[model samples]
Target chain A: MKTFGGPVLFLDRDDINTDEIIPARYLTEITKEDLKPYILEDLKLPGFDPKGETTKAARVIVTRANFGCGSSREHAPWVFEVNGITAVIAESFARIFRQNMFNCGMTAIELKKDVIDALFSYQDCPDTCITLDLVGQTLTVQGGGREESFAFEIAPFDKALVLAGGWVDYADKKY
Target chain B: MGKTTAEKIFASHLVDEPFPGAKVLRLDVVMCHEITTPIAIADLVARGKDRVFDPTKIKAVIDHVTPSKDSKTATQAKILRDWARRQGVRDFFDVGANGVCHALFPEKGFIRPGYTIIMGDSHTCTHGAFGAFAAGVGTTDLEVGILKGVCAFREPKTIRINLNGTLPRGVYAKDVILYVIGQLGVNGATDRVLEFRGPVVDAMSMESRMTLTNMAIEAGGTSGICMPDQVTVDYLWPFIKDQFASKEAAVAEFRSWWSDDDASYDKVYDFDLSELEPLVTFGYKPDQVKTVTEMAGTPVDQVYLGSCTNGRLEDLRVAASMLKGRTLAPTVRGILSPATPKVFQDALKEGLIDVFMEAGFCVTNPTCGACLGMSTGVLAEGEVCAATTNRNFQGRMGKGGMVHLLSPASSIAAAIEGKIADPRKYLPE
Candidate 1:
């Protein structure tokens, strides 16, 4: 598994629904690159991708429990993946996104509150780093050597999907 | 070393059950709404899955974004209508015919006991009122469900919401649910199936019981069900095939899901109906609520009185009766959307339409329209409105529009006051 590099930006909120991730009007996409521009439209950020500027670089998302907690619109992951979000670490994830991301080859790390808060506090220091070891089920912040291990219990079938770089690859390998 | 009937169902369907005590498991049925279907269908088409697993099993309704107010949205609705038809979804409950898909499905008998049902809409758990494992899923799952006829899940630790006593007169079933959401918050019941039991639940009508279980997903739940009893049998017998037709058999089937006297739950929540004031959510979240008595001084921009959650005929009757002899409060828009054309016709036959029109409420055709911001009744500014629909997320009703979740009774009460008001104040106490 790829260790998500770089400091984390934490979003603390509840019921972060899919419509806000990427609104419904842009449901049709020609490619994953098409969805990067609108990730977190509801966040009211400036430079709000007027022409669908899909994410061009990797950004790790750190969130609260039940992150991705609303409608099972796959846009949540599509936007995240296209936007260069390499992985997500949350206390809990909506069942659909957790499954969809794995199928899409986006990694998710279930972290405890301390790690989440630690990552958020370091947001000002962009150079901070966090390392994830899939084999060890461990996640650690490089600063001050603070680390927390979370057991990300992935089913063998799902792990294969992740290892194969998504459901399509896994399905091709199997059938 | 024992299992609940739900447990048995999960085990039987397990492609491979996860380790012990794990909430995740495999699924059998999945459901979706227009909001999610447009994308799910696109995915399925991309994959070249021409036919859905079983058209009859898939129920797609145009409750959201129908009766389009503008020409642009009207064209969009037309597109969705043709797509659903082309997709071979047999049960396309359209706007006039479509009540809330969740309410109309069970009312029309699509949901059966001991079966698995899924919907793209989060409120899909509304099917669990019939003792089915109904839960809402997103579009990705919808695409998979349409092709594969199954989804994955983790068996949730069940919660027994024991109703301790009979409800006092005038305390309708919506109060039971608002009380739960109030206590549980939006995520309190996450990934858990809530089984309603106790003396109070026994006293509720099947329609009323549905309203309670219907909002299960509001709490991020797997499903909320009530133990099927005689009421379950009688309500469902007419819909089942004669081979599975006996009410006694249906009741027997449902009773098997009931917890033994000593059954355990991950958590227990209890409510006293005698104390429940008519409830309404004050803000954009279902859990952001207050009693109707708490509404006296709140502000509002509009009132929406329909959705799958509270768009039934019974819901309208109560609202119309309250507005029967009274004029509506000024400036607060009250949009009365029936769940289906039949419901609309029923209201017309019963003069509920006349009452609504006279009371200044704009009656619309059945469609899950405005609640989803698809079209019609879009609001402006930081306006706060009360609605009977599920979910009050930002922009759910329209750009910058805020929705406060309430029951049909509460919406009407707030409508008459032009702010939030206790239904008890307007309706007979």
Candidate 2:
């Protein structure tokens, strides 16, 4: 099994689409690495800057419902992967994007709406960090001298895909 | 137990039950376009597994940024072209022959009832209009579909949306779907198949049904399907006549894919279209919709009439009826891109192209260009547009621009008025 966690970046918005995740203009780039600098380049959130220090420092993203809601571009997850962001925790995710994340060997965790509401309280803390325990199916959040843990679930096959480090590896073993 | 249409299709295509709720099913068609397919091609090549499961089952198109806007896009097209040639795929459509993938593939009669199709483009759901189970996937699933002829999925539940009542005058399929999405919200049908039924759907043409199913992804639906009928048989007769003994036989074969009367659904919603008005999306999300009356006089800088959603010949005829002799507002720019070369030719023959150009609209080739801001009709900063496309997401047409999603009739109304307006005024009483 594999685990993930790190500095958390909070984007308090619903329906953050793939276009905002990585603009379509850059999709022609030849390699995954070509997408790194353009992560969240088109996002219009109130205070989040694509070039800001928080964007560069974060390794996980916590957002409201329906993250990655538009288009079926796998480049959205590839951008997150190239940026070293291993997990995205949201109240819900657009179906194809959630699948794309797991296909890339990354994690897309869904928590309850109220739990997402409670997590947002830690966004302003400079030291806010999160960790996932895949074996235990638990998520722990720590920041500002406070800590909380929550349980989550993944489908048996999706868990296996993540454990095998994404679809390519899983297909290599099975097919 | 009675099975929903989606369940029936899935059960028929089942290759393996990988887990309790997941099934791996064989694919009937795997569609590809330059934008997304090149990446899958590159990945498969890098793995030393550069091969296709069946050359005949693959349909490739160069629609996204056709005529290659830049060297990078040119390279993407070249990669796809080389891969298709190497694999002996015969259904490839290049620039002049290319239209938008979602529009071109179906125009060629490639989709059929009871079929299972997958594509890397989100609008692949558009093919579900023929009673097929079609859904979009990412690069990995697409690669798997290409190489193994199969892809896996979680068992899907059905949401039966019964659109009843006579459609009000001036309201089209685009307006109905926009209204449905508004009621369902953006994530209303997430992970579920939307089975469109009742009198309203039964009366729609194949072009209109395609428009309805094309926006399935906007509601987070896996696919949107309609039960196959004589209308479907007639639409496909030109291409499928040889495969069946008669049109009646073709219709009978397709009826087997329909959901039983006693089929259980996750949920059911009924909509009455008699009072429906021309609707348009106000915000970035597809679900942020309002009737044109609610948004009248909201100024726009541009008006776009095209996309897989509303660029069909029927759509062009509707727009032309309104633009027959009227000129666009002085400050507003108008663009019309027919979805396919066939659509373009038909429009020209019908004199619809002259009506549009005489009314000051610029007619461009069929590319999904301006819809995704790749080229053709990109918007300037802070500019607003009324478009007949599936999406109105932020910066969807250009950076810092706004798009109001509407039907072709309503879009033309906005072009003439230079703001959001109702199309009913232009319709003959």
Candidate 3:
């Protein structure tokens, strides 16, 4: 699931809770695919229409601190996965949200505050390309004759699961 | 070596090296609710694994989205019910009989000291109040536990929060915990286990301890535990004594789970409970707490006093006492829900229900109710409320409905005044 480069959908808000990720009204649907279209609907974020050109074309979601801060609903990460968002880079994540991301086999990386701010600055330039290298523990932003790399870390178990295409695949092999 | 309460419980479940790191640990109880169980069952069925590893250890409760708000949620509840029956899971609780899973699990004697527990809801940390090492896992992990009888953990470090001194009047578990969360930011204790020790914890009642542990997850802690002592046994005895050979045996078993005196901790914090006042959270995050006195008279449209947190019998009693003979403001609407059916029955028997009803409070049957913003007393857009529930995030109470989390006493005060008011005036000095 490693993508070489993609457009970044910058959600620059801090403390983006699960309630905002996918509201409780949308949680009754058991399937991830059905729940994807409603992601961030509660927050009323700009340009969040799931079927719209921008949200569909954006492969990466960059945000500030405490992304997915409330509730343990896996639907928050499932929305990103089912909607074709492969990577989510934030300043930090709530533990359960990060765990949910790994469980769904999506890459959730945490960069420093400065690195996240740098990424958020590119929101105006939608054409900017950010490449995530899971194996190399680095995120590269390349565009307009500028390329910068930021290093990050993931727990050994999460790394293995994400590399193995999520928890189900890992369980299929390990269990 | 001295082990923290969490390390002690985790080691008890370890089949190999005792240190904290990635390893499969045995689980004594695995819990699920309507919102999370359907996905877990679907995943298991997709893998062609219909049988649960241990039917007896699994608990399925239909608490969230109960009363069939919509056909979709109703179908999900039906799926959980049918799956639990087919799997021979004996602990399933259908709508009327079930309350919040966090309360019902421990109330039904599923959680024991020194045990490792996992549930699909984040507030599963509430079970850690019994000195059990419990944490909330996502649906996938719950599925893994159902199939494997074990769940993986990365062995959490311990933070010892030493709360001492007797609490001031009108300041209780909710206030102390909210104050702690305020001091320690929302992510302060992320991935760490919190060991609540010191004199204040020992003096607190079982219900109060549960409130403390229940919100520990709000601070991002993996688990919050208190040492099992006489207070623990006394509270759990009535419900769990029959399971053991004798009362002495049950007490002895739980007593053995205490942490060593010299136990080394990764970090420690000291707090004097007397310094706390009634706390109310103003912003979206729980950590944005302020003293009730500071935010009193802040206007509100609704007041909710129920959830896994602060929804027990004691919590109702506190609210009832404050609301007795006093009617809510014409502008304010109050909704009260007990944490469990037993709590509702006890409140009814004690006439606490009359006290609330007489004051124009809408008392409902036990369910998660409006805590998750699913059903029963949903707030309209742009409405503000003072609530006793845990989280105050956007859309937590309803779409565009703002919630300020407070203790039960403060919640009643807010209702009576039609705004956030200091609850200390209602309590004895």
Please write out the lDDT profile of model 1 over residues B6-117, one tens digit for every residue: 6655655655433344333344455555555665566556667656767667777655566555554455446456766887766776555666677677777776667777
lDDT tens readout by residue for model 2, B333-371 = 999999999999999999999999999999999999999
Q: Per-prediction DockQ scores?
A: 0.33, 0.79, 0.59
Docking class of 3: medium
Q: In candidate 3, which residue pairs clash?
A: none
Q: Per-residue lDDT for B69 in model 2?
A: 91
lDDT of 2 at B108: 96
- Chain B of candidate 2 achieves a TM-score of 0.99
Best model number under lDDT:
2
TM-scores of all predicted structures: 0.88, 0.98, 0.96
Index of the highest-TM-score prediction: 2
Preferred candidate (lDDT higher): 2 or 3: 2
Write down the lDDT of every candidate, Cα atoms only: 0.69, 0.92, 0.84
TM-score order, best first, reads 2, 3, 1
Error of 1 at B289 (Å): 2.2
> What tens digits encode model 3's per-residue C-alpha lDDT throughout B106-208?
7887877888888888888888888999988888888877887777777888898999899988888999899989988898888888889989998899899
